[model samples]
Target chain A: MIEIQTDPLLYRVQKPEVRERFEALKQRPVVLSVQNLYKTFESQTGTVTALKDVSFDVYRREFMCVIGPSGCGKSTLIRILAGLESSSDGKVLLDGNPVTGPGPDRGMVFQSYTLFPWLTVKQNVMFGPRMSGKRGTSAESEARQWIDLVGLSKFENSYPHQLSGGMKQRVAIARALANRPRILLMDEPFGALDAQTRCQMQSYLLQIWRNLDITILFITHDLDEAAFLADRILVLKANPGEVNEIIEVPVPRPRSAAQFITPEFIATKYRIDQLIHPDQGSPEDALPFPRMTPQGDDVE
Target chain B: MLTMFSFSLPLLAWCAVSYLPFLWHPDVELQISADREGVTTVYTPGDRVSEEFFPEFEAAVRTQNEEVSPFMSLDKPVEAGSESSVRRSNKKVLRHLAPLLVSNGWLTEEQTKDDAAIYVAWKEIATGARLPEQPALTEENLEIVRKNWALMSRYSDSYNADNFVSRPLLSLVPQGRPANPDYLPAPHRVLISGFKEFTKPAEAERPSMWQRVGHSMRIVFGGFLLAALVGVPIGVICGTYSFFSKLIEPFTDFFRYMPAPTFSTLLVVIFLANDAPKMALVFIGTIFQLILVVANTTRRLELPLLEAAQTLGANQAQLLTRVVIPGILPNLYNDLRILLGWAWTWLVIAELVGVKSGLTEFIETQGRWRNFDSVYPVIILIGLIGFFTDQILSFIRGFIFPWTSEGPAITSTPVAKVLLFVPRWFKSAVDERIPYQPESTSPNKA
Candidate 1:
């Protein structure tokens, strides 16, 4: 997925259907909070701190994007939230309780093609339910529904190895959704695709997320991606990694890459560019965006 | 290929040296000098020389030689006599010499009294004797004359064939009736070449050469057939279900490496009270090796393929019958390749102690006698039989693994394909699983 460098999981900020579905989806009544989280890896050279004192809050059905430099522990934070990994110090609360181990409640989409190479696309999508150890016929039927939803009905029997990278990831997303987890944790899921495939995947992801009111914790490295996909972006810094700032696009609901040329989109783009690289904030300055605070308030 | 050369080059060199003399000097040509006036050339005495002219060879050794001796007496002087009397004496020498010639392989079952004349005639010319028939040589007498010279030259100083323990004088008969012949040596040299061309042998003797080849053929054919018979069902069972595999695993694990001799010895001890102890030992030895093949191959039945069926919810029975067996068959045949090889080693070892009639026994007997001539041929026969059987097994592999040679493997991944197709012994074993089938896919019989 080429656009991985642009924005790992930030879905395309376009398509009127995504807006329509967003309005149509029934929001899950749940809240999430990251309280002073910290994560570190022990290596032969000693410990490398990946996250330090990172904190944030997400309301029911809110789309949150975690953005930072390469290897900045944005993944670590998302993994911690999904309970795929344990945080060294901190608590990630879902519905007011600390998250623990991976369960049916939160479905995760990894960056790799985890579609189980041996199984077909449809079977891959149905895996979560099947692993839940239900009957096979029913699983197949439910798998078909998701297959149709992802517009991959024709490829239901196509193996992951046979499908293109984007196709494989779409199957992964569908599988995550089929489980009907309250929260969707995407860990740079589009990072492996080629550029064109990444764009196409982003648009599809937006469409699906809109149709389903799943709370999404989308992680990425692309600043523009953070602006385009997130209702709110948690901008993080490397080295004792922390949330450096929060920025909002303030754009209207429906958007597209075509809107990227607009004066308002360009202005907001400048604000993020300045926040990430303030010294370079000069006559080249362009897009304007509102910087939000950790208090969840505007810097009035 | 490197390993093949590593194993074959030395053997090839040995064969080259062993047979090199045959290529350069097929007839064992020798030069004779009676008075040292000049050397007279001699060729081996056989119809083959008359049938196939050695024009260049004959011209090369064209010299003069003269001596008045016929048949050589190993340790005595040849007394001269009248032409007819000496000729009659030589003929009598051959007929009377039949038993001794038979012992030394110069005669055969069918040789009779009339045949001794041929030996005498050839012996006369071979000694550079002035034969009355050779005036002076008539085409008839000269032919017999040249042959006699060849026989004498065959035993010249180099061969020292006169060392036949004893000898006698010879006579040249010039006055015999030209119309009818009295006797001759048998048509050919029955002494064998380099001592390796011993006959096929009769049943009672079960000569060392025959025992090795015959015994190995039984095992190669029988062990192969038995392994196929044995490996199929068990391989399918163990391959299909990990449980049957698990159930048999402990025993196979314990016995697989127990040393075939030990296995046979133990079986013999336990089954000694039975009627046919040796037969029982062989059966036990074969069974143990076969189970090892089945269990080992079963444990590694191309996991990806089996997993495909398992994930499909194929019941254990279905897995066993359809996916496991069919998919693993090529592998089972491949196991037959290895199984037969191991079985042969075991068979030899089993026959070593318990049984006394197989090739190993032949070798043991010959070894005790220090008759390496008898022993080596058997060993060679064993090798030849082993080669042929391996080829048979491979021919079977080629059929069963038709996909291996022709198209993509049943599995898509190269690794999976290799794991599903190549025999374990041949495999580099880069992975944990081995791929083989136990069956007779040989186009020859099965």
Candidate 2:
């Protein structure tokens, strides 16, 4: 077996105090635990394994980000944790109980704008509470608190169609959070936003995470976003996807856009890029297209 | 302005065809008429003949009148054996002047049937006491009236049926004006006839126009409401679950193609001869299409809405009632509106099947008699009913589904306010029930 520290791609730079921070994080009780999870889909070409021997734990109040290249089964893994899809083998436990199906204990936010169009922002937020048998004024008051938490109190009465893309997602986040779940499962929740809006959302999410006691398992394919938000990053590989490595994000928190170029943040993002793109060479050499442009040094 | 023009254009066309006498009056409507000696067909005033035939008719009557005059001067007393026939023929001559007298406002409609009153009117006209103004009597017709009255006064000064003149009166020459066919009456004639038909009291067994209108509305609304009641739930179920869709849609798809009218005889047999069968046909005509349309609309509900509800910890029942129902409501409402129009297309056929009833029945009867002036009003009324109902429903849709962008923005009109009042009140009532909490106050500031 190759020595991990000796491998150039596996080298990680970290702050001197990062080891103590990691030890403290590990002491927190596990809120969600996955054991030997496997998922297979029966396509026309017989059974195809989507995820194989996937296992990870999300500690209480911890912010974990799962990053991978395309087709890495990151979405499938998050869906399984959300109880939207079932694993072919192994188990998912929330706290101490086995997760059989979607419940109020696990809240979910999708990449798409999933706010109920017919309902107002407040009504959309109140939906989970109402479904669990909270009705009338009490549900409305609780929903208002969440709307307040997401900083969308002004738009509480406006319908989803009346709101902008960022505002709609904010309502969606408010709706998911209103359930008061132990863990929040997000499947690339900011994937569809513009870059500026996405950056703003990342900061907003970090602020919300700091204030609430809720744990989050966020899935994304962006290395910078993983480094910026996650206390620890879980990297996944494709073709019968499996866990490649779990990196402790050594960038000190109270993070801002200013920290994006810090030595610790850059080291963390670079390590993720290497793992997700292991064979990155000159892609132009593989293309057989004939070049029709005039030969000139000015093109570069 | 355009809506007004759309309606007025048709009205203008109709008026042009009706009032323009020189345009296409192929036949002549008689103002004065006479009978032939050997012919069984008696032509009366207001009867129409081809313009070519009018002159021949006048010549025949004039030739017969010459023969009658020479015979009357002979003063041959009528035989007792032929007295009744002679009186009958003279009475017919007297009635010819009745149409002219009625138009001059000298006789009432009831008096035209009274031979005694007609006898008196003849004396008045011959004596120049009652002069016909609009269609003044021709010199020739006036001479024939005076000669006939001279002979009639010899029997009695006033009309007495027993002593009525027992000799044939001289027939007046036929006179007429150019006119359209009997089926294409002038606009004023149609308006007058329509007014009479509407205001006419229910005579013995016949119903009034209002009753017919009410009955027609009942058939359409009853059948449509029943179909909606039954079809909406089934459609929603089929749309919500694939198992239900596979089980129900295939059969419904097959059933819709069989044609609802084909089952008319079967419906009549099962429901018997009444409104039941007619309504059943409408129900059948509407329900199958409604199911398919509503199912398709429900299926079109965004999948993300359903998945979102599922993740919100909603159970199966809550998902259906809260999410699926509300999510598909606006579209389903639109589908039902369109399907209601589909239901109306079956009305004419449905009403004809067994024990014909409603406006369709009236249209069929009047149409058969070729009284198109009377038929026009009923047909127009049905069209107006459908048009106005659709327009009103479309307007109300804006108030009902304010969330949908297809509708106009909600306004503060009184009707809209009244429509929106109940839901708003209910929401506010729920809000009021919460206990006051000072710490949670001004949540927006958070």
Candidate 3:
């Protein structure tokens, strides 16, 4: 009785050979694994549980998106993976090593523009390499390559204050990538941008991910963004927030924003939506009331 | 434009009211002449008749001149112009002279006459005649007589000129020429030390005003540098760590309240009686405030930036040098500039400790002698230097920290350029210590 064999929809959407390849890839190696993670915040008021019993695994070079409604601890989960926040219970392992605190191995992009204002665009990209003890002509050339990769070659000498919102984010991405970390953690990187800039950034991010071959864990509230960008989506439930389900999108790779209108994309979004709000009707017949997904004993 | 006009209206009114009446007056020129050996004399062009016959009146009127006057008899009026007119003018001088002489017991009231009696009394007094109850003629008493005579001379001259009330304000700005040298020597006359014969030898012994100002600057710079060296580090430590902040807080707070100059006794004991004590006074005056100001400024540095640097693999020292120090520099520079001005105030207090050759010391000695001509310029010179120092510091701040909007400036000087490159050199030094990992050529390179 194979558990994966019971899921017929997944089999129908993905050819058997492709499904076999995915199952093989899943077993290849676990780059990052979280086990029963819990985070509690205690203040003058009573303690509020921000995350509870959260568990997931990310494969090498995979694009994973975590989506949840507001106050569902989506950000907390990503922050924990970034080693910026520690989990109260259980542990996180990055490539077989226990996660302790922020280190050079994991690069993070915050929702706010965190580019060093005192540094120029080139200097900001070079910061990681320089701080880690890389100097001279070679390190500079490497920094320039990353800057050029982010399409900010002409703005190498410009300070962060001189750059626009989107440009500043690009520099931040370049800065993080310059260190060449194994995994990239983005916490609502495009959340502050306008709708048009957000769409453009989403496309640029996808292009960079494809080119870099680096694993990514992106957190966003937008379902469409998750459906368009994720290889697998982690859905979380609020009020002592915990992972509801982890659903894989069986869509073809090398996709663009145009694929968002396709049937497969819509179906994957619908499935995730149902998993999030099982009691509510389909997204088209969306109820005015708040959606609350039923809790399930779904752990992997 | 209207706001500017409103702001300037009061200043314009003050200038107009202060000087317009003086501008309207004509023939306000009054030549004050003094015979080199005898008393200084002043002669107004409007009173030529009196000027010709009454050289004694000329000598008496110019109050500031301290030269001893020769005893001249009124019976023999100077042989100038007509004899009858000279005698007539002699009677006018006699009336003014009579009251002063009678008060000093030089002449008895019984001897007073309507016309020629004063001339007869003057002759008698000049020949050493003394009253029955007259006090002994000592030097002090004779000095008092000379001052009284000068006072009467001024009263008679002004009373005779008649235009005293409407005298031009421009001529009264205290230049040497238009004023009576014996009276209030004009400001310029007091200033002209080049005529060294007139100036006291003691006044000649001091260094020039500019040299004294330079001494003040050297003391201020020494104190300011020491304060910065000691204070900035303490501030940085207190700001970055909570333990140090709590530990240093009470002392810094208490010391700021206690006046700095009050430490002069302790400073003299510690630094000894020399330049050290004076500079120590300035150092103590500014260091405590500088520490607190810089500490407060350092505490305000954004925490996220520090976290960001920490995640970037920066150690504690690197984080301070690269992020925290640079982050607080612009504001710290502003704090130092303001504190430097405060240090200048301490210069007056500091120079009082032991050194008596600084600008403030020069001011003190000159003030005692009332040579305000040199004093006022020294004060203005201090102000100018302070203003210019502030300007130059701000200018350099901009050149060094161009990233900040406050100092949105760039370096052109070779020294400033070298200083700006120091961080890069420091970064390279930091880089050299960390082991380098050869990066794999990623297939992702496009």
How well is each residue in A1-300 modelled by candidate 2, as lDDT tens digits? 222332343225444577778888899999999999999999999999999999899898899999999998999998888788899998999997999987878889999888887888988999998898888665677777888888998988888878888788888888888888889889899999999999999999999888888899999988888999999999999988999999988788789999987667777877888889889743565668675667674453
Q: Please give, for residues B1-446, the per-residue lDDT of candidate 1 as tens digits.
A: 99899869976665554445433233321111011123344222211232123444333323211133333433435454444554444444334333333433444646644453435534544465534321133343355445444444444422232332122232222111111111111112112421443455555655545445565456445644654576557655665567887787568667656555555566668766332444444445566567666666666655534433333334446556655565556666766676666556555655555556567776787678555445555566666666777887665464455434234433455655576676643555642243322232211121
RMSD after Cα superposition, model 1: 15.7
What is candidate 3's TM-score for chain A? 0.87
What are the lDDT figures for the candidates, one per model? Answer: 0.57, 0.85, 0.70
For candidate 1, please provide the TM-score of chain A on its own: 0.80
Worst 10 residues of 1 chain B by lDDT: B176-185
Candidate 3 — which residues are off by over 4 angstroms? A1-25, A267-300, B1-17, B20-204, B366-375, B406-446
Proportion of the native interface contacts kept in model 3: 0.33
Q: Is the docking of candidate 3 incorrect, acceptable, medium or high quality?
A: acceptable
Count of clashes, each model: 41, 0, 7
Number of the predicted model whose lDDT against the real structure is largest: 2
lDDT of 1: 0.57
Off by over 4 Å in 1: A1-31, A267-300, B1-109, B112-446
The docking quality of candidate 3, as DockQ, is: 0.23
The 10-residue segment with the lowest total lDDT in model 3 chain B? B167-176
What does candidate 2's lDDT look like per residue over B172-273, in tens digits? 788788888888888788888889888988766788999988888888889999999999999999998999999999999999898888999999999999
